[model samples]
Target: MDAVQGTLDELGTPLSEVTFVVFDLETTGGSAAEHAITEIGAVKVRAGEIIGEFATLVDPGGPIPPFISVLTGITDAMVIAAPRIEAVLPAFLEFIKGTTLVAHNAGFDTGFVKAACAAHGYPPPVNPVVDTVDLARRVLTRDETPNCKLGTLAKLFRSGVEPCHRALQDARATVDVLHGLIERAGSFQVHTLEELKSFVRAPTPEQQRKRHLAESVPHSPGVYLFEDERGEVLYIGKSTNLRNRVRSYFTAGETRPRIREMIGIAERVRHIVCTTGLEAEVRELRLIGQAKPRYNRRSRFPEKVVWLKLTDEPFPRLSIVRDLKDDGAAYLGPFTSGRAADDARIALHEALPLRQCTQRLTERTRRAACVLAEMGRCGAPCEGRESPADYAVHVENARRAMLSDVGPVFTALEARMERLSVEQRYEEASVDRDRLAAYVRAAARMQHLSSLTTIPQMVAASPAFDGRWEIHVIRYGRLTAAGVMPRGAHPTPFVEALVATAETVRPGPGPIHAASAEETECILRWLESPGVRLVEVDGDWALPSGGAARHKARIEHAYRGLERRRAAEGRPLR
Candidate 1:
């Protein structure tokens, strides 16, 4: 087996290979939208060597404020003969073409340039930008510099060129500050331009001392556990490269306050190496559920997950349930919350005439009809007013609506909404629309889940970055097992291994149930990702064209429009 490479593959351009253009601008005011540029200075550098320089004073087409003139020494007379911004901007854009733009408080400088470009009717340059102030905040502490001002950084880095409120000289000072920050970042192993851009959280001295904890971790795809002094797990995470990922937690790269606190309490770093990224992800989910680590926010309360089930009875009714069993019923969730389950149930009731009562009804059973039946909302099976045969037809219709067809339900809801709108009951119409949307959303989710569950066995593969294929064996839409196959290796052996090691996950209580919603969603996301290939499928796996899936997008779009109108009118959206 080949060793799995780290997640941060050598894909991004290395820092040494990138060209940086450090620039500075002296403006008449602080607001880029309101201010005018007085002077521009830029230096183009590659691999620590200056290759080009640009400096110019621009005529603001207005008077230079005396305070600004005193500060920058760029008087109206100095720029009296200088070219206007319309002329200077184009040349400056050409000078920094195909290079990362850098400046202290980059937003201030880049904002001015972009505004100038817009005003000149020129398309703004799309080059990547780097902000030294942001970079300094990530790599330096307050003790290193009182603030992230250009003058402060110049003095801290002891740059040979001191800033004297002049554009060109300040640009030189920023160049030194950029180099100093980049060199300091090397200690954290941030050598790629991508890493430098993303580096923001500064690691404390305590975290730096614990760097050795990651040294022994393998540079392979796996899950890592952060344990406190008592050997209790504080958090669990997965990554393509165990070593690099764990090392990141001990560096400035880890930003979340909860994670920082967890790291401070973490005494040991442990790992479980996996053969493929899929397996690593699955293991991480399983571990988080099992350990319920303090820092793991999601997937920790799987037991609390609820489902909307259509009861297996003569008059099938929908109810919210917590556990799934091998009962012959149709289920629509593993909904994240009780409120969501209730919303889906209400949507179904609005479209179907199924009974809402809890009493079991037989041919001879007798009970008073509820208000729902009195209002013609239910078939009144509890009162024996509806025959078993007739109720069975309604049950079948509800079943079809939940599992196969949903057109009638949406049509009914839409007609009701239209009637309410014609009556000028806008609030009632809105409520009807919301119920309709909920039904569509739930139906779409069920359809997606149904498409997968219909398959008994499936073998899916996606190309991995390390010249291998990530193979997953899914049984009943739940990941039974997963493995990696070499680029040119035969599938027979890997397939056999996957089957032999496959876990036997019991199907949910209902025939439609597969797994927890979180796990199913994870699998769905991976299957929908780019480059996934279906190696083998034992049964049908496809979405229905005429089902509620077709109406989801249109309904969601209308819902968004309604929300915007409500927000504009300052009306509460319910």
Candidate 2:
């Protein structure tokens, strides 16, 4: 049953003549302009048969945010040695040169890729795109499906495919789902590039409703709800553009089958516009928890898996408990996995001299210490020689270290060793350095932690001096700040100040809006002066004290205050 050909109209040759490149991308965020892609997975299909596949991590020329790293398991280290997009994209383009792009959610992935390519001045892709999502919606009855999530559809069709967030696996899964749908439908049509483009009618009434809903949606910031015919929530999402976000579902091509089904059933849409993106995200998370939408997969449960805590008994036996039970015990495992908890317990026990036997401690009892105690590894609590109270104190200190500042301390210790290396102190510093590195490695293995900084209102916005025009700063999403700079402008003190300022930046006015070339040059020169000040430099970026100890302390206080203020007010950081 070659459904690829069978599903198409007679105007089209057998579907075997058609080719598709199933692709997926791991990115920093949902927005194409704001986020970046870290990895790409692709599989080629020709005539209903898999031909070749490719997957690669690409250096996005920026730090991979911790949230993204946690979600994708693609860390900065994994991409550090990978080729940059500029070096890899051309090769990728060649690989899929003549094939149609096929993605579960095609628009988002393709839109992002287009943006990335445009940023680097590459020609936009001319190949056609086939959305599995659109096909499911057009063929399946909305009420019967109720919801069309990739996972749900896979289950509905009894496809027996495992779901993962990975790019290639997902792309392949989408292909499988499409195959299953085509075989099941028995009656459907697949159009070629030219025919599809020709028949692509004006946005349907459903599409118009979505467009109007999107247009009416306040662009300020908010969460939107997509509901099916039965009034059951199909999906929950938040966006800075409420209307655009909702309309996205209607314009679907490469969306997941479940989402396509959801859109098919969607008889109504509603939205809540917020004051900011951060607020919208928080509200969305809360709403997802409250609604527990059938299509949503993320867990809302606060309790992650428990870890094992040791040092309860004389042997400090490992046990899995949510919290520490009593006074004379420092416990450890309440970790996600028992194996992980056990590994951590072993590391802790090795670091401290403790009885490794499964024996109890009693006052006045004497027995041969276990190997750990015999070898100076354990403070022989098994023989009742080491006071439980003293042992508990040690355990508490170790537990605190593991919980809080160990990683930073380890890093500092290594840096100190590196500094000492220049002074010929390697012999003395080597042991401590090795110990510190081991500790850091252990901490990393435990669970990589990342700090969430206040999302900056303005990031590095200017293109590196490209000899074309002056740079300008935009404020509150408006073009309030502007300055001119010559092509290849050197970084002077005022330029440094402008760059360091927390002000939002935007592109300069076009030549049509310019007064004169020389006038523009003059404005650029003025901006270049050390006396110029743009928006008020907020916080440490504006600080002029050269970062003395007091300045550092003040900055720390300000950051903590800001964090607390946001927490208390339930406000997103500005």
Candidate 3:
């Protein structure tokens, strides 16, 4: 029986065999941010045997309050010559390296340690922590113990050492309580450390192992990155409250299979704090576009965007092209897909009589007209039946429709849809309605982007949650720099500093000249959102008078009418 038990123990997972550093800290007060550590005590154990012990008096460099001195024995006179936290932190950290840390209420002790590390310029420890109080609650019944406090659990478990409001004594008592809880936990078949943590339900076992990754993330707007062991980025995301958002991924509420797989593989979570949620969103899009991380599905393929171009020729034709050039031709899009560009193209053809042919047309060089000429849909500019002077009118109108006015397309498509609906041609009406909707949507988007891209620079501010202002500097529609302005501070200096350090954007050939369409769209949404106040602008920041704004209402009304009709007739909407 002894031999068999030895063999089983040798093969068992790590909980029974793992080393632990049970530590305690006595501080001048409760808040780690406000108080200073006065003493550190730790006991390192393995397999219920003490391997080492460390105890030190830390000179807090401040006078301890009389009440604090009364709670814990040490006073101002006792710690005056003690080593500073900076001098003792390295030794304490070295002793506890690569071991699970345990304490009665871990946050109080660990917060001070983390605060010391941050204050003294040391990286915070990523060691897994086991809180004895939490473990006791999970494993011990109310009948077994009235409370999970250190002194209460220590007495119930019959610990050899009693806590007396001193660092080393409390640490020794916590070690005993932790062992008692572990022994009780084995009755439920939780032998391994992972199983023990699972028994405690530390959020979840896998995420709990790495939940320390989110400890440093701030509770502010930011972008986050999940990276693998090789430091390769696996996912990039943004959030309004970065700490809360990152922590949510490790909880049971996160149910996405792909994300769960990502969590298992992720080793570190990195963050970039932003001045506002909008900047974080824009940065997320830009980083995803640049990194093209394996897990991010958006902003991956900017090169595939298609546009509608009105060719500059003797007899101009509307062409769907993949490239945007600064050659004085009217361009309409950064359309995501070729199919969407085609829909907009069809809508333009339905509204205007422009020649559609693969062959180029010159006034002197005439070719044969196709079926479109016979149907009177085209002016037959390719066959000399249309003069260049007359063809120029169609081309000009096409340009105006693409760049400034989508009203004609809206009016024509609406009339055609009404006629088709009256004749009971529902499918054709739906198709025409979709086509015109696509054109109006694209025109409105382009006009909105053009309003920002044409401006040389702009400064805007919005109120922050903390009674301050979040300011941004934009040059040619690209966000350059962001900063916070204190309440009641003068804006001139803050705005000037931001502008001086802002990113230098050189405008290019498209509707969104200095940034990707997604980035510009995000910026536009932020600008248009409530509470944003424009501080300064170098040029006109208004949409054109003849742009597609008027067509939006018509499209919305058409959609509502279609929904009402479908509901009445019991038809599934396309």
Q: lDDT tens digits, residues 447-538, model 1?
A: 88777876778889999876888889888878888887888889888888888898775555443455655666678788989999998898
Off by over 4 Å in 3: 1-210, 553-574
Top TM-score model: 3
lDDT of 3 by residue, 391-430 (tens): 8888888998999988888888878876765565656766
RMSD of each: 16.5, 16.8, 25.3
Specify the highest-lDDT model's number.
3
Q: Of models 2 and 3, which has the larger TM-score?
A: 3
Query: What is the total number of backbone clashes in candidate 3?
Result: 1
lDDT of 2 by residue, 1-574 (tens): 6555544454654445767788878776666776677888888987668899988888988886433443455667789998887887887788789888876657767877898789888898988886555555555654556544566566666665554657777777777876766554445344344444322232344554545545566665688877777778767888877876666766733234455545556767778876444446556766776776766655333244444455544335545455434455443323444555555555444455445565566655688776776677677775776887867765654555444335334434535554555454645454443344334333332222111011122212233234433344423222223344456556464455555563443323211111112222223333345534443323222211221223223223323322332232121111
TM-score of each: 0.60, 0.42, 0.61
Task: Give candidate 1's whole-model lDDT.
Answer: 0.78
lDDT of 3: 0.81
Q: Rate the local accuracy (lDDT) of all candidates.
A: 0.78, 0.54, 0.81
Residue 95 of candidate 3: its Cα lDDT? Answer: 97
